[model samples]
Every structure is written in C-alpha cells, then in structure tokens.
Target chain A: MTTETHLVVAVLTVVAVAVIVRMVRRGVLKAKYTVLWLTVGLVLAVAASVPTLLDTVADRLGIWYQPTLFLMLAIGFLLLVAMHFSYELSRLEKRVRALAEELALLRGPVPDDTADGGATGDGSG
Target chain B: MRTAVIIPAFDEADALPAVLAELAAHVPDHEVVVVDDGSTDGTHRVAAAAGATCLRLPFNLGIGGALRLGFRYAATQGFDRAYQFDADGQHDASQIPALLAGLDDADMVVGSRFSDDRGYRVGRSRGLAMALLRLLVRRVTGRRFTDTSSGFRAFRRPVLEFFATEYPMEYMESVEALVLAVRSGFTVREVPVVMHDRAAGTASNRNLRLAYHFVRLLIVLLAGGRATGHTPQVAR
Candidate 1:
C-alpha cells in the first residue's frame, strides 16, 4: 500500500494546523513559541496546498528526491529550535538561581516558613 | 580591623558546636557568620546558640551558594576582611591568624595544603585530577597554585565585596572563583597551612559527581568564561 507524498503531507499539514490552533487558543503555548509553530504550520500549508511548490523548489535545487529536501529542511529547523531552547533554558536557570539567592538575602537569618511569624502578628480582629 | 569568619555548614551540627567554640576562644574579636545550607538537622540552632550570626538558606544551594551568602552578609555589614573555615572541625581555629596575616600583602590568600609536606593524601586518580587542575589554574591565571580547591582561604574587603555577588555557583567553585579573581587582576597568593581530618561526619566526595564537575571545570577553564571582573566599583 503506497501513499502519495502530497496526500501524506496534506494530511499532516491539516493535523498540525489544528493542533497548533488548539494549543494556542487553550493558552498552553506562549506567544513566542506560538509564532514559531504558526510559521511552521504556514510553511506546511504552502507545501500541501500548492502541491508543486516543494517539487518546484526541490527541482530547482536539483534534488531528485523531493521528500529528501523536505526532510532535510525539517531536520535543520528542528535542530535550530532545539539550540534556541537550550539557550533559553540556560538563561532561565541563571535567573532562577539569582532569584533564589535574592530571596535568601531578603529573608535574612530567620525563616518565615513556620507559622510563628503569622501567629505573632496582631490578629486581634 | 573588623574581620568575619564565614562558615558554610550543611548538616554539620555535630561538629559545628565545637568548631564555633574554638573560633570564639581563638578569635574573639572576629565576628562569625554561619550559613546554614538548608540542613534538616538543628544546625541553625547550634549556630545561633553558639552566638554566631546564622543565615539559614531556604534550601541547599551547595557550598558555593552558602559561602556567597556569607560573603554578601559580611560585606554588607562593613566587615574589613573574612576567612572561610570548615564546619567539620577539620580546620584549626588557631591557624586563623596566620591565614589573616597573609592579607597584609595579598588581596586573597589561599591556605594550600600541598605547599609543604602537610601529609594530605588523596586517591591516585584524584591526585592526578588535582594536579591537572593546578596546571589548568596556572595556565588560565598566569600564576602558580599548589592547591586550587582548598576551602581554607581569606579575602580582604575589596575581594569579599567582589565575591558577594560574583562567586561561582558550581559544585567545584573554589577553583573557578580563584581563576575569576586572578583573571580580574586581583593579587592572589597560596600559603602552606595544616588542616586535620574530619573529627565527625563523612566528606561529601562522590567520585561520579566529582568526575562530572571535573569535566565541567575543564570546559570552564579552557572556554574563557566571564573573566571581566576588573570593574572600578571595588575600592582598593
């Protein structure tokens, strides 16, 4: 059972667009990443709707296997996204560490985790 | 000169009481600041009862983080100098004056155990690693150091204030801090000092973690990290 490349990619584009829209509407994805996935969706939409677009581009690039071009581009894009995520994660970790140190400095030698501070407060009402 | 002893303790309650007592007996004029590294034990109470100003961290941020807080506290309180002493009683309080005496000539004094025949022994691989680290330190800072990881060290007000915010937060931070200070153009010296075996509690040395941190430190040393600490903010 052989499936045509256009049909497969078309189905994938529909599913990807639906999932991306749902995720964005549900507020699960941040605006920055939402823009990223939306751009990915738009590229997929262009490739699927204009069935000859990938073939035309791949042909111009002299790639005999059109799907190879798609796969290569996808892999490259994913690698860049992964690298960006790693950079962001390192930055966030540093900020969080700084916050932890700041919190410790502000809390002083005493810990307000216990109910003692609240209990001693004027709860006369 | 106003001096502070920065003791970073994590579950060393058994040994800390004696350590604090010795510090009090030996260096009465020096203020002691104990950083309780989120110990589940009553380490804060031990430090407080011993008349040491204890800063209890919300959670364990490792030894580097604890010392940073202690340094920050000491600097903000206007202490002219500070020395780090082990909470396990491995560090002798009598030698504190000798450590501080080094401040007369250098901005930072590292109490190196290998400077003389102090008989401090480690495993063969660990010794190799330390030797490699010593080489790396010498290469990066353009200076020689016999011990790169000795916790027994002292710093003047300028260096203490500098480390208040810029101390490395990594596991093996002493070496990194050493490199940072030297790279930032501060004078550093290593002096021979005698340290004892822990009177209580096990040393926190895991080969796996140590090896991992060793590789990370190799990268840090070779990679030319944030070495721009030569700001004019710190007064001479």
Candidate 2:
C-alpha cells in the first residue's frame, strides 16, 4: 500500500511540474516570479517519497514532534495555492487598469488617470 | 541648465509633500518628474498637487525600473541633467547645488553622507553591509565611494543616455549606475551631502536581508559589467 501511494504521488508531482514548465514557456506564467512556488511544490513532492526526511527538518527547526505527512502536504499545498491566487489577483488588477484607462480615454479623460498633467493650486513641501 | 529631478515614489505620500516643498524652495528651476511606481496610497494626488510632472508606472516596478523610466523621459524631453531623488525624505534638497557643481568635472555626481559631517543612522548590520559594499566598489571600479547605495545622485546627458538604454531593472541601480558610468569611461565624482533617516514608512530590508542584497549586488558587479552593453571597452 505504501509503495503504491508513493508511486502515485510521484507521478502526480512529475505531471504538475511538467504542466508548470509548459505554462511558463507558453507565457501563461513567469518563471522568475514562480520560483518560490515551484520550489515549495518540488520540496513537498520529494518529502512525500521519503518519510524520514521530516525528522531531519523537524530537528533543524527545533520542533519537538515529527510533523505528520498529511500536515506537511497540506501546508505546502496551502502555500502554492496562495501563490496562485496572488498571481491571479495581479493579472486581474492589470486587466482592470487597462479597462479603466480605455474607459477614461473613451470618455475623453474626465478626471481619471490623465488628470495629472495640468496646473493645480497644490504647492510643494 | 534644463534639469529634471526624477523622484521614484512608492507609497510615500506622507513624506513626499515635505520633500516636494524643499525641492520647490531649493531647486525650483528644475522640472520635477515624479515616477509613481504604482503606489496604493494617494501618492499620485500628492505629486499632482505639488505640480510635479508625473510618470505613473502601471505596476510596482522596483527602483531600477522607476529610474530607467525617469532617465528615458529625461532623454526624450531634452533635459541637460537628471537627479535621482529619494521619495522617503532622507535625501536633502539643499545639496543640489553641490551635486550640480560637481557635474562639470565628472559625467555623474554622487551625494555622499560620509563626505561631510552629516551623519546617517541605520542598524549596525547595515553599516557593516555598507562597509562590505565600499570594499566591493573599490575593488571593482578602482574608486573609493563611501556610499555606493545612496539614491541621491545627479547625471548629465551622457550618463542619462547610458542608463536609459542599459539600466538593470532591480535593486542595484546605485551600484550599477556607478559601474556603468565607470565602464563607459565617464568620470564620476562624489560630493558632500547630508543624509537623514527616513521620516515615514519602514524599510523593505531588516538587517540580515540587507546584507543579502549587498552580497547579491557584489556578485552582479563582479560578473564583468558587460552584459548591458553599457561599457564601450570589453573587459580584459
């Protein structure tokens, strides 16, 4: 049972990494920005294959009890999920800004992003 | 001289008003170009209120990205000189005269806190890190720069063009500017200036992380300052 579970997890991990790399190459994501996320994923995948690795990390961090395999997997997944949401939020924000700028232009710059260049009564420090 | 002061502001609304006021009082003849690098605060309103020519970057590109945009604007607008002024109120506007005066002999003039009696305080680790940086700059550029990471500096047209095309868009703009200037056979001079602690906003780096950035810059600098094609002569 243990051997089968490890094999399944390994296959899934490889597929996930391959997908991420493909997405990065296709410009769907950026490699530099995704390094931390990819590293967390890879570390979790490797740790899952070797149960003893948890003891070493736990000892180094001065944690008393050995962390459960499920907990480790959950924590790693949470981090990667957070990263995904961050990237998505930034992308959405960019799209919104573009839309806002387009709307402002169509409306002939009615006190939006383009209202900055004119003279104003506000003085400097 | 037609000068443009490039102020890269990141959520610096609280401190910028005072800095802009000082600039107006001291360097009013120069056109101010505030590069608002996607600040969430009312930085754009403050800059606009202060009557600065603003360049709103769509995202929070780092300091290098902001400065490169500023340099490009300066080049296109035909400014004779551009000064990189910090938005955090640490740089003194009163030193603009000394910086501009030094520009006659050198292509770029750097304002150094250690060059005068003015004392700037940070964590002890930062001081050690800057000492390491001074060593690295001495080794790499063959010039003794007391503060290689100070953002308070002025660049003439030639140095402005060099940065507009080849400025590395990261945290290493101060060091990279010095290296690029030296590599391009441009004379660089350091002048006495007062540096104060920032009035508002926390620094992005704590002590240990600050050391990490210094080490990162040294590695980038030692990698043979040639990748950006800013240097005319190939490293031997």
Best by TM-score: 1
lDDT of 2 by residue, A1-125 (tens): 14555565667777877877777678876666578557756875776677567667777766675544446756877888789889888666445543432332242211223355653542221
State the lDDT of candidate 1 residue by residue for B64-135, as single tens digits: 888887888888989999999999887888888788889999999999889998897777897899999999
TM-score of chain B of 1: 0.93
Best by DockQ: 1
Comparing only chain B with the true structure, the TM-scores of all models are: 0.93, 0.90
lDDT of 2 at B130: 76
Candidate 1 backbone overlaps, count = 0
Complex DockQ per candidate: 0.27, 0.04
The candidate that achieves the highest lDDT relative to the unseen native structure: 1
DockQ-derived CAPRI band for the predicted complex in model 1: acceptable
- The per-prediction tally of clashing pairs is 0, 2
lDDT (tens digit, per residue) of candidate 2 on B64-85: 7677767877886789998999
Interface Cα root-mean-square deviation for all models: 7.4, 11.2
